[model samples]
Target: MKLTETTFQDGTPVDGYGPGFFRIGGQRYEGAVLVLPGQVAAWGGYEDTAPLIAAAGDVDVILVGTGAMMTHLPPAFRSALEQAGIGVEQMASEQACRTYNVLLGEGRRVALALLPA
Candidate 1:
């Protein structure tokens, strides 16, 4: 599956990562969106970098989830996102993914901000 296009501020098309897709906001991302956990680790470590980078692609809202269990988006990570001009929201990884799915289903352009396990 792929991150399909959805109606949102960005108005850009969403592309999927691979099989077993997870839709957030309105975009579909499969597998792990945090393809390069090491590259931007300092931004806030693994807990913050993943979703921030993934949202860089073509997403309107990047809902960041700091960890596998219910977690919070680190303060530093939020600052980076604010500077990047990407609107961000916070939620758990599981919740973020589920929200992404709903946004996708609703034709909303959103991306999942998650921390890799």
Candidate 2:
């Protein structure tokens, strides 16, 4: 079998993640983070909807990382994004990171709102 490198043509892929931080595109970011195509920013968790909302036009879906365990998003928060026509998927941080990288490598319009794992 031959091995091939995965290349993300549209955005930065998640490189690694740990207890309180994530290494994205070779950059370290602590706390929650929001990663959109070609950009990454410090996120303020679920309550911080402005940045996600602002990205509605740039993304088709957002994968939300709920720390180490999977959890449901707040009703209001989910509602707000849905109202903005943004699709939201909630999963554990580790999974979110992996999924985000896969979708990004496909050149899909996707984003990540991740909590530390």
Candidate 3:
């Protein structure tokens, strides 16, 4: 049998999450957050599309964490990203964090736009 450590070369993985916060790398972020390769910042939820759109060239897809449960993205929100050539995936906050870490470990270009969970 073989085992290997999950290494995130380009960015940090989600360490933990609960209630209304997420701990990444070793830092705790409150409220909504935008997690991009090698960068993490506060996000203004759905209305804040500039940051996400600006990240289009850096990422292929974005995993959107819609609080504690999965929910459909607003039509305009989805459209804006798609128009910018960025794919969007909607899921619960917990799932999004897990998926983001996995993808990051694989060296895929991905980001996270998360609401509180």
lDDT per residue for candidate 3 within 12-112, as digits (tens), equals 78999999899988999999999987689999989999999999999999999999999999999999999999999999999999999999999999999
Top candidate (lDDT): 3
Per-model TM-score, in order, reads 0.51, 0.97, 0.96
Q: Enumerate residue pairs that collide in model 3.
A: none
Q: What is each predicted model's overall lDDT from 0 to 1?
A: 0.51, 0.93, 0.94
Judging by TM-score against the true structure, name the best candidate: 2
Error of 1 at 113 (Å): 2.5
- Residue-pair clashes per prediction, in order, are 12, 0, 0
| Positional deviation of residue 27's Cα in model 3 after best superposition, in angstroms | 0.2
lDDT by residue (61-92, candidate 2, tens digit) is 99999999999899999999999999999999
Q: What is the C-alpha RMSD of each candidate to the true structure, in Å?
A: 8.3, 0.8, 0.9
